[model samples]
Target: MPATPVADPFDALDPVARRATPRVRIAVGAAVVLFIAAVAIAALVSSAATGGGAQGTIVAGGGAPATDLGVAAASDGGASGSPRVATPPLLVHVLGAVTRPGLVELAAGARVVDAVAAAGGFTAEADPAGVNLARPVVDGEQLMVLAVGQAPPPATGGAGASSGATADGTVHLNTADVAALDTLPRIGPALAQRIIDWREANGPFTSIDQLLEVAGIGDTVFSGLADKVAP
Candidate 1:
């Protein structure tokens, strides 16, 4: 029997082709890296051209506009750089059963009720008479309304003060007049006259303590009048 000859391993392969496996793998890897780099570059270019953010910056719920990073005008800072404007002033007066009744400055066009509201509103003893809560207030005007069953405010002199006082030895300075000022235990017509004369010399009193400045009125007299008067 004759034996068959085996083919040589080296003889079956081309010499040049044997070296191509490493080069082929390296070329494929490079192609993949280049494809990834090309996609990244395209994305960057698209974002720059559209001026939107990389992830997209379209605002929801009616907000500000999103500008592209590419536009010069959008990035340059908008039309006006100044802040908001301020409003004007208003002035009104309140007089009646309130904590404080006097000229009050407020924003212009403020209502009469607003002035009353500022003066701490009507007091518990305030007279609802002649008072219209819904009425609009005008500047530099006066509002006078007392509470129900409440006497009208004392006149701005000694008589009003004595009338406003009670058996408890207290006076309602808001309503006191010249005659009322004489009603004080120690006050007589002469001293009362002095108080009225002093009040005429000065404008509306700012503090009851200022009463001491009147002739025949000293610390003793003023101390008695202190709790009995209001500015």
Candidate 2:
């Protein structure tokens, strides 16, 4: 046969080249498939990284509710919850007419009665009624009890300054005799006598409020008596 006329080099295919053409096409197709797969994988990895970062941002802080700035919860009370510090026990100065008239160590919120109990309770001469047993005690405060017929030290303006009546004409609640007490408003001879009787039975009057404890004295009578006396 005459030599074949060839326009391109590839067109002049011998038996060996013709046999290799299918393999070359397959290699090129494989290279293209690998390139597309790598691009898709790269996009997926980038998307995953961005999504993870967004999730982390939300977890850090967003859409959180307001609070009392944790003030109410910071302590069972202020300076109370801090483990490094502790509140000291109350040092109540329980003096006069208690069995042990001195400072008594007590817990917070202790009452006068508790202090009296801690100080070995009231002496036989101690006016338990005069001590305001129901009143809460204070730290570093002076609580003085009285015996029968005793008067507390004078208050400002000479109130309760005398055994009978002060210059301001206020009757001393504890030391006033029946005649002096009778001078008060609504106090007749019988009521005046009763005032003295109550002081003898109870301890000395620590507060004029004690007038209500007398058998014949009521709120109406005590109201009339309130401004006329001091203790």
Q: How many residue pairs clash (N, CA or C atoms closer than 3 angstroms) in each of the candidate models, in the order given?
A: 28, 0
Candidate 2: tens digits of C-alpha lDDT, residues 1-231: 999876876678998998899999999999999999999999989989887445422212342223442454354254334555556889876667878888899898888789889888878886555545666655665566777557555333432333367767688877764445656777754676677668867878888898888888899988987887887
| C-alpha lDDT of residue 42 in model 2 | 92
**Superposed Cα deviation of residue 231, candidate 2 (Å):** 19
lDDT of 1 by residue, 116-206 (tens): 7888877888754435454444444455545566544434444332344555546544334333555565775456546655665686667
Model 1 spans with C-alpha error above 4 angstroms? 1-85, 147-231
TM-score of 1: 0.34
RMSD of each: 15.4, 11.5
Give the TM-score comparing model 2 with the true structure, all chains together.
Answer: 0.34
Task: Show the lowest summed lDDT stretch of 10 residues, model 2.
Answer: 56-65
